[model samples]
Target: MNRNAMTYRLFPAVFLLASAVATAAGTATVTQPEKLREQPGSSSWSIMELHRRTTVRVLETRRDWVQVEADGNRRGWVREQSLSMDAPTQNAFASPTRQPVGTDLPPVPRTAPRASNHALLLSLGSAAPASRQDATHAAAIARLMGVPDANIRQPAQAELTLDGLRKALVDLDARMGDRDRAFIHVSGNSTRLREAGRCSTGFTLPTSKDVLTATELAAHVRSLAHRADKLVLLIDTRAGAGACQASEDTVTHSLNEGKSRNILYLGATQEASTTPANSQGGLFTQALLACLDGRATLSAAAGMPTGRELVDCTRTTLANHPGARPLVTLAGNGNLIPAPVMPRGDAISPHALLTALHAQRDERRQISVNGLRTNYRAGGKPMRFTLTSSQPGYLHVVAASNDGFTLLYPNQIDPLGRIERTLTVTLPAQDNQTRPAPRASQSKATLLFLVTDGPRNFFRAGLSRAGAFAAAPADARTLRDLPLEILGGDNSPTCTRSETRNLGPSQLLLCSTSFGSALQEITETP
Candidate 1:
């Protein structure tokens, strides 16, 4: 018969529970003999019997089978009658706390100090040609983040059975030692990506039909959140336009409510092909890999140049996307702290980075707040402002500060910190400036201009030198009609104009001019 048929045939007989009987002495013997199947008596086949009693732990019973855990903590199902549950066996199995069975086994304790206190769960993508790069990057990130590969629970590809996934999770749990931190990496392949998403819901593969669904993923993740001190989910995709968005949505929608506090999502944007060829991987992915490798930090790769800069690298990454824009949204009940500001002109040492992170926690004792804000510009206009306050959540600050623009939260400090509101000050116009006549030589040239109002320091100006000024008409409404000319007999383009304004030093406002051909030149007075 086929393997499926054989597996089906074995299922019914395997789950039949054995009757439990107690002796007068309150002790019981397992009368049933554990059955070990032998290959059909073929000339080349040999029966390998495993009779060792002391090396395994019978953790749980399912129908007639028991989940047997080996000394190495490898768990698998065994026939209910595989062994005699005599008084000695019963005593041995009764207390996992007691000495484990099996004298032939290595004398070294099977239970390592690190294994007892923590557990891990891992899910790998199901796609072929697994993204080894992502796996390697993830492992590195985990290490820097304080998780070692030895503690990681990698999925076994050879074992296509659902039992494989379960065994992996169990093994990971057994190996974690004392850190109850769970790190899950979702590499390429949509199916495995989907599976990882589902695992977060609580359903295990090989599970009955009753347990398979997206809801199970969220449930599992939620359950894991409660069981583990920290749970991190990392996804590495092709960064193809909507890939990151789709994956992020899947994660958000599948995760159980209130469990998001324990989760973190990282995605890379696809790179442009036209740009100078750098590497085979996506730019963002490469940056992330560098971060994992301990060669870079999110801030550094995002252009802050150093990790000490407490800037939101996400925005920078998005800004760098070739043809598309990237946006990162943090939603959940947990506090979002602004990473510490990187010291100016200093490379971020690991010690300094950690110290900054720790400082946020320390400051939290003094304040409590939570806030959320979205920062985006459309048509050079800024709009849409929303804030939610929590006594002990996050102090969301959205601004273009000198410290390289960022939206920060006091995560290391109190969650209930309040961010100052943005102040908008309109500059008064300068009426004393006279418009210069259009220069005859300014036409047919790309205009480089700067426009700002005069007195209050807000004015607009334009310039061109390739042709006569008549070629470029200026509209008073849009400043397109501004005169363009070369001043002081210089072959290079120049413009001069003077404007008077009444404003106090306290009211002065400084803003960078928009960089473009239009801002190339401004006619001004000597």
Candidate 2:
């Protein structure tokens, strides 16, 4: 609640400079895009981003953070380098009391004012059973943004319909009248907005017609979007195939009237993306949540995912599911999601986090989640095995099929514990598709491990000891739907040092390390 338009957009930019250069400089012009942050550090969240060549009058300065004013409310801190110190020469002699001949007033700084000061997003999930997964994902995203759990809307009501959805949106609109930078994620319907093809698979599967017809829903969304500075409408359902390919037309129509603000529209499939009522989440929603989970390398940094990267991550992660095609539409260049903020009283600072990250990378290299070759199994047995580790670390194991991820180690029998040297565990038997089983002679799985360096329970978010992941409808699942934060967080016990060599890919590397999924394998014992 003590949040401000904050970010250390200056952190990386200012890290290289000395204190002397941080003095209050003269008015300047922005030579490149500049992100205004609320605080003076690199890890702070960005409040507003100004484009290249924009001009501003310098107001004050702090270490590498320069406070500038382009207008009344457009005042914030940005890194000094983002602006050109050589502001357009202004006549020093010119004064309001007496102007010199041919005196030229400084041209108005080329700045586009923001629509609002703050943003309040609501992730509305369909109360229907089939749509619960979609709502679950929306809630996860809201959680990622550090949005309070109370503000996030879920399908808790006995009956869910279109009218209820509209009323909710209407109430939220009234509550958020022209607030700045408000971001919202509504997960209910899917559409390729251009063709007006909408499907409420998650909603209808529960055996109720959407209170609002497709047209009415679109109209309602447009009306609500009319007030926001940025809107990210996540469609959990996918529209039926109808000559219209999975495309970025979803928000084009709804947000056209309010195009001045930024909007990032995403849906699972232009063609109906499916989720069995029992699946962990809708096909597209699963990938979306994973990308936002701070693990996906959509960008060099894990601050948050951008609109463009969201499409790329979802497309590739969901590729194996040929039927579910996720699409994206970008209305403007802006980051709608706020970077994850650590809980207060947490000692982990931005500098400390950056240091920890570098240390973790080095540790990842030295350690190994080696699938040890046992004396009993000459070639290699996927079923009978002993999984060894080079050092003490937190490990999660999963097996992947073209179908989806099946949790292995963090199961009921072999829970996620601090392993010092090695762990003796078994892979699922062949033909047992649920756990890590060998398909080819060597099935692939990943050893998703992190060195505690003696630091444990990073997020302190407890790990799941359940025997299995939440069941997915035999179809439409993507990756394991478990508590991924078990991996770690800002305040999680930190890694002390890096090891010598990193573990390489295994013959049975099933999980995609690139996508941030988890898995660890052990050679089956004889």
Candidate 3:
């Protein structure tokens, strides 16, 4: 063959060799890992760090960062530079047809499980109003557990006759699969001892009428302790004479002997009795509801560092009755001081209280997923929802539940759409023994977004469908086709507006103009 022909044949072999070398060098692809950022120069703060590698599946990506799950099933964030687009494989240049890599990538993280649906027994003491408070608190707890609003039983009145209490328990048992624990509310004088069809002081010395006698209430509590998985007892009363002493003794005895998985007892006493104040009970109720909604441990919610508040409150209330333990007043430790009597019926508005409770409940539920972070993307569009606050100055987002109801939060959204910084939520498991056939219900989940310009805000039409535009001054008429709900107005005299629309079977869009223009969409599961 001629020299030129020979050279051409050799050139093909040389080119093939070069191509092989390039392929072996390994391709470098840009990947954005999930990360958590902290402020600079703070003892409690830490800077940006890689949480996971790019080879893992990217659940979602935004402008600044991406969320990924690692091979070991951990999820977190890393800077965009920390990730590379290298295809995960056992051998760098292995043939595509060959087994790609180490045991198939780990399973995706599952959303937190729903709380158990079971009957929640609530016991009320002498105060009829306290019953209502307990019911409200129970509703808040239910929300925290991801229980649908339709599943919660909020009695019309607090005071249930003995028959009513029994019937309520039975009905709740049927609805809740009979495995739920009971909540006992002991407050006020309505529970005073009764004789000859009239209210009167009982013979029991140094004990309050609101609480159970050491013998009677103890037996009932013990029975419940054995039958239920958890028991929450609350004592809301003034430390005074009569049945207060017995009530304390009964509760203390039960706590010492109870074997329930979780037991929470709270007590508050009046510092001084002047005219009855409604705010006192309301405040305690508010705090309790907040705690329950926040899903805070009992100790944190009661502000009881040593778990001795209940013991002390019981001791003081009982000491006033004859034949009771001596009132043991300990030195102050700079804890909360008892407040003087509040004005009678100086209670918070029910609407305001419900709104607040809903906000907290929403917040608690939003943080259910663990080990994730969030960042916004530049090109992504905004989603909007209405923002309403019973109390002004509170801006928050609401999340949907598995059952399709909106859960509101009291604060801003976290990196992973969680309401707060914390992760890990505890939920009660289904009690199969009592509920063989769980109730059949439809899922109608929606998220309610609330932005605040003042203490009390409304979901105005102008703010609707505001998610389509990022904080720009675009005319509303320009974006009429999108699903939006106008809320309030901009800093200018222009009317503020928010937008709301359904995203999918499990998601809702909420947009706001309050904090430098933001759009948030919350998703629910059924």
Which model scores highest in lDDT? 2
- Highest-TM-score candidate: 2
lDDT of 2 by residue, 237-321 (tens): 4454333443234345445555533455554434443533323446666665555553232442222235555667667666745
Would you list the rank order by TM-score, best first? Answer: 2, 1, 3
Tens digit of per-residue lDDT, candidate 1, span 1-526: 2222322343333223213111111211122222222321123232222332222344555676555433222345555655444223111111123335542211111111121122232323333323333443344344434332234344534532345554654555444322144565544322222344332222223222222233444445565555443455544333222112243444556553454644544433232232332223223444443332322334432212222221244344335445434333333222322111121223433222222222222211233212212322212222222332221222323112111111122212222333333212211121223223434432211111111111111012222221111111222211211111100011111100100012232221111110111111112221
Worst 10 residues of 1 by lDDT: 491-500
Is candidate 1 or 3 superior in TM-score? 1
In candidate 2, residue 185 scores what lDDT? 50
**Candidate 3 C-alpha lDDT tens digits along 24-110:** 423222222234333211232333333221133344445545444432233444344555644432211122343345533221122
- Give the range where candidate 3 is weakest over 10 consecutive residues by summed lDDT: 491-500
TM-score of each: 0.33, 0.36, 0.29
| Model 1, CA-based lDDT | 0.30
Candidate 2 CA-lDDT value: 0.41
